[model samples]
Target: MDKLKGKGKEAVGKLTGDRRKESEGKADQVKGRAKDAVDEAGDRAKGVKDSLRSDDDR
Candidate 1:
């Protein structure tokens, strides 16, 4: 999602030779990656919790 958009912005910046845009694009990519990692962690945690609940019910 955002990662793809950031990549597009980065490519456009490089083609247009916009240093500011290029930097912003790179920042966006980093932010996107960080957010993705956080989301993955949250999902994993939820999965573990769900598993525990199911096991307790059984």
Candidate 2:
């Protein structure tokens, strides 16, 4: 969502020649990607923990 919003803002900034908006848009995209990475890591950790629990049952 943030990435999509950033893309739109970046496009608009380019059309309107606003340097600040363009930089902000770029920052938003980076933030979105970082959030996605953290979420993925958390999910992987949960999966590992679940597997460990199942192993204990056996």
Candidate 3:
């Protein structure tokens, strides 16, 4: 969501020649990607834990 929004902002900034907006847009993209990486890592950990539990049940 943020990534897509940031991309739009960046595109608009570029089209309108706004340096501040472009910088902000770039920052937002980075922040969004960082959040996604954290979420994916957490999900992977949960999956591993669930698999281990299932194995133990057998």
Candidates in order, TM-scores: namely 0.81, 0.88, 0.87
Sorting all predicted structures by lDDT, with the top scorer first, yields 3, 2, 1
User: Which regions of candidate 1 fall more than 4 Å away from where they truly are?
Assistant: 54-58
How many pairs collide in each candidate, listed in order? 0, 0, 0
Per-prediction CA RMSD (Å): 1.8, 1.9, 1.8
- In what order do the candidates fall by TM-score, top score first? 2, 3, 1
Segments of candidate 3 deviating more than 4 angstroms: 55-58
Q: Is candidate 2 or candidate 3 better by lDDT?
A: 3
Q: Candidate 3: lDDT of 32? A: 95
lDDT of 2: 0.89
lDDT of 3 by residue, 1-58 (tens): 8898889889989999998888888988998999999999999998888788865575
Model 1, position 15, has a per-residue lDDT of 96
**Winner by lDDT:** 3
Per-candidate local distance difference test: 0.88, 0.89, 0.89
lDDT of 2 by residue, 21-42 (tens): 9988898899889999999999
Query: lDDT tens string, model 1, 1-58?
Result: 7777888889999999998888888888998999999999999998888888865585
Cα misplacement distance, residue 45 of candidate 1 (Å): 0.4
Of candidates 3 and 2, the better by TM-score: 2
